[model samples]
Structure formats: structure tokens, C-alpha cells
Target: MIDTRLSDPKLNDEQGRVLALQRYQILDTPREAPFDRIAGLVKAVMQVPIAIISLIDSERQWFKSCIGMGDTTETTREVSFCTHTIQAREPLYIPDARLDPRFATNPLVTGAPFIRSYVGVPLCTPDGYNVGSLCAIDTIPREYTPSQIEVLKSFAALAAEELELRRVAQIDFVTGAATRRGFTVEVDKAIARYGRYARSSALLVLDLDHFKKVNDTWGHAAGDAVLRAVGAKLNALLRATDVLGRLGGEEFGILLAEATLRDASRSAERFRKAIEAIEIENDPPIKVTASFGISAIGPEHATADQWLAEADLALYAAKRGGRNRSCIAPSSAETQLSRPA
Candidate 1:
């Protein structure tokens, strides 16, 4: 968790976090070459038994790739030398973990893995969040020249820049979703081969109701909280296969590939409830809600735009009927209801 008491250094830090992590295409991925090469070189050059390209996430420091290690790819940030390295933004060289005040009792140093000596370089994102670290660890104390430390930090910066550029290229800055350009490029391939590979797909358009009221009554900060809340709900409720993106302010879009209208509605209703349950904790206290419209593509549909429009129309009808409800399309038919009121 981010420390709430201290003034946030980067307000946009969380916005790009998901996107930055995703762009690496590294998490949960099978271990591979590029990162392995870097890790291998760290062990060879630094003469340490362990080297890792570690990415610190919300809960843990996960290794994108590693070498000279087995069955110990990640650990909590509380026990990480990388966490301190990130904050200091300098090489953290602990010559003797048992004697240093900052690390004397640290678990990773005193407990299993018994790190007696450590050196780590912070990996910073472009706008400057310390996203991770490149570290070499030894079981015994060691000394390194200042020049060697500088070189390792330079390499960490290069790796961080590579990861940051990928996020800048593919994600929406505001909502942490794939940019429309990125989504369009990918969605076409999915639709073109529709049933040949997968079944039908569904599109959903969501509009937050009384959003202007939130901004008017509480301020834009409150409005931002509402938007982030909505995004978080959709992100949590949707399946891994579904693609969710914020189309623009107060409006979001989703693509549920291989999902039927019923399946889409089920997922949509879950998100609806999730949003309704959220109570934004901004000063003066704020409560927010949303409405959703859904449309599914059958074999007869010709274009993605058509499906999006259908969802939008249904969303409009949902607004007209009432806020905080869901409307499913084919406007001629009675709208399908989600959560009552």
C-alpha cells in the first residue's frame, strides 16, 4: 500500500502503474532470454550468487527474470533491499547487513537467504516512480568501487526506460486502459476471425450518472475519485479475457470477446453493484453511481462501430429511464434489467 500520510510525490503514479506493468509482458510469463541475459551478466560481473530484475508491485517484488536463484522469485516489499534502493534512488550497498542500522534486523539479511552483503540499483519509470530494481546479492560481505556501482545503476535505468516507453506507446494516460489506437489495432484481429477462433463478442458502454453533480458539489477531485472507483470496479469484476477502457471522461467502454449478451449482462451487473457499493472517501464524503448499456455482435454484424453505437443507444435509454440501472440493446425489445434501483 502507498503511504497515505506523506505527501504523494507523483499523483499520476497509480494511473500508469497497471499499464506500465502490463507493457513489460513479463509477469506470469514464462522465463525468457533478454532478462535472463541481464541477470546472468550481473552474477558474472558482480560475483554474486543471485541477480534479479525485480518489479515491485502493490504487494510484492516479482522478478521479471532471474539467475543463480531457484524457487525464490519474489518476496514482500517490507523485506526488500530494493525498496530502500528505490527510495534513495542510488546504489544501496550494504557491506555488512548485520551491522548497518537500516538493515541490521531485516529479515532477508538475518533470516533464510541470509544476505550478508547486497547491492541494488533502482529502476525508475520515466515520470519517476521507482517501479523496481536490479540487484546482486552475496552470502558474504564484499566491497565495490564507486565506478562499479555507477555502471550497474546505468544499466538499471536502461531497463526501466525500455519498460516505460512501452507503456507510453500503448496506454490511455487518464484511465490506465489501452489507448483507443492500441485497442483498435488489437480488436480488429479478434473480430475478423470471430467464430473461426472464438464465438460472438459483446460491447458495453458505461456512463456515470450525476457525475457533473459530483464535480459541482464536491469538486473535480471528487469527480476523479468517482471515475477511479468506477474503473477499479470494472477492472476487478471483468474476466481476464475482457478488455475494459475509459473512452473519455465519465464514459467507459468494454469488449467481452466470446461472450453472449447474457454473459455480458451478468458481468455488467456485477460491475454495477460493485460501483454502487463504493463510497468515495474524499473530503466532505461522496457517493457515486453509474448506468450501463450493452450490445452483442452476432454473425450478421459488419463493423465494430455499429456494435459500439448500439451500446451507446442502450446507455442513453438507461439514462432516460433512470440512473443506476443497466439497459441492454436491440432498442425495439424490452430492456433487460440488472440490479433493481
Candidate 2:
């Protein structure tokens, strides 16, 4: 049985909170020793049957590390105790769920794992959003002292710091987009999601047309300025779910989550036009244009490199077809689609 009247808990700044969570790029990633060790320590120190490092996403509460919950990695947000945990700054301590109206009919309480005691400390980001929780669960009623709660909060801070370190390393200094390594990691996650859930997505690789000429004529400083401006402009045009990254010099990559080939084509065209419209205030004013290559994630691609190679092929096609255009790689069933910007 479940509580039919239990409403989904949400933060007042939910959109901002989810965006802050996404900035870490941690969801669906493989477990690391730091997080696993923290969960293990919590379980040991708290003397709980289960301890988890959980991240609350839009639709699910995903466990970055789980101990004592057999093979279960996630649960629907509708049924998650962690959902309620993320709504506040302080730890949520339930001494006996069976006595609490909120959990009296909750599935996790009435069913397997038979959770009775719980404590969750919200994992707050640097920007002050509670993105998830570090929780300890027990199958029987138990009491937690203020000292115990403080210990959990200290663990939660370490988890938040771990997330911040990853975020800082992923960002590009000049463009403010993900660096090459970060972007590729995102692509790998997208691919894993596609394989597991059949979620469709597309990748767009953009290269500035005649970018060398900008450096030769204006100097490296001006070239850097152009990259920065272009990054900012493209970022403004993107949805919160889209990932923008600087792949390398004069090149960028975008991961369009849950988008189809047609959706990607339209997006690529828009980016092409946006890049073409960029103007830098140089001695005589400078304008720049970009070429785009798009490839939809599919079964044919086994690795991120293969997916990127396909997009690169389309990019070369765009270059051959004359720059300032968007081109789609030929699928197994169809020929390449190239559109002038």
C-alpha cells in the first residue's frame, strides 16, 4: 500500500536546483571510492542496515552509492523518502515511520526493506540548493541523538565538496563551457542512458569557419575573445538540459538529451545561424561563421569515439559543401542531409 494523498515535495527554486544538480554532471555515473567509502562509513558509524548517497533528479532518486539495499539503484520520486529529505537544509529524522502519518502508508515502509527509522541530511551545493541527501535507514524503530545528526551533516558536507571539485574541473576557463574531457564524459553518460532506456539524443559538433584567419589578422587575444563570446551566445540559446562544451581550439560540442535526428537538425541549423551572427568589436569589427555536424545516437555506435567520428565526418562534409552550413551524417538507411545556413 502507498499514501494516495502524499504530494510530491519540491523546492521553491526547483528549476534552479535541478540546474545546479546538472552542473555537477554526476547523475548515472559509475560509483567512485570516495562516495562509496562515505556511504560505508555512514552505515558503520550510524549502525544502520542501509546507507545511501542519493541524488534527487526530476523524476527519480538515484543512488550514487547504496549499501544494504539489494541491487536497487533508484526509485520513483513519488515514493522516495529522500524526496522529502531534499526539501530542507537540516536533517530529516524519523524515529518510527510506522507512527508517522507521512510514512504510515508509504510503500517502502509497508513493503520490502520495511523501513522504520530514517535520517537524511540534505546535500547542499555551493549555490545553496539542496540537490540530494546522505541517508541512513533502519528496518526497526531507533533513536538518533543530536550528536548523531551532526555527524550525518558533516558527511553531507564532504559529499557536497566532492561534487564541487568535479564541477570546477569540468568547466573551461575562457568559454565557461565543459572542457573536452567533461564533454566526452557527458556523451558517455548519454550513450549509457540511450542503451538502457532507449532515450533518443543527438550530438552537434561545431567548428568556426576560417578561425585561423581571425588569429592571424586580429591576434590570439582577439581570437580568445571571439571564442568566449561565441560560447556565451550559444549557451544563451540552449535549453537547460542541453550540454555545451569546448572540444578544443575553435571547436565545440553539444549534447541534446532526448532529442531525435529531426530535432537535432533544427537545433544544428539554429546554432549555425547563431554563430554566423556573432560580431566581435575589433579595430574594424569582425564577424564569424561556423560549420556544424550532427549525429543521432543509435545502436550502430558502440563507443563515444565512434559517435564523435561520425559527427566529424559530417563536419568535413560541411567544410566540403562550403562552410557556414549544417550537415547530418548518413544513417544506415538514408543519405546525408546537408542544409546551408
lDDT of 1 at 95: 88
- Candidate 1 segments whose C-alpha is farther than 4 A from its true place: 1-8, 11-25, 168-341
lDDT tens string, model 1, 1-341? 45432564542454355445544445655676767888888888778898888887767788887776686778887887876776654577888888898888998787878888888997876655667789888888888889878878877877777666765777666566666655654455456657476566778788888888998988887788777777766777776667777677788888887877788888789878888888888666687778999887655445666656778999998999987888888741333343244
**Candidate 2 overall lDDT versus native:** 0.89
Winning model by TM-score? 2
Candidate 2: TM-score? 0.82
Error of 2 at 304 (Å): 2.3
TM-score of 1: 0.54
**Which 10 successive residues of model 1 have the least lDDT summed?**
331-340
Q: Model 2 over residues 173-221: C-alpha lDDT tens digits?
A: 8998999999998898889888999998899999999999999998999
Error of 2 at 324 (Å): 1.9
For model 2, what is the alpha-carbon lDDT of residue 179?
96
TM-score for all models, in order of appearance? 0.54, 0.82
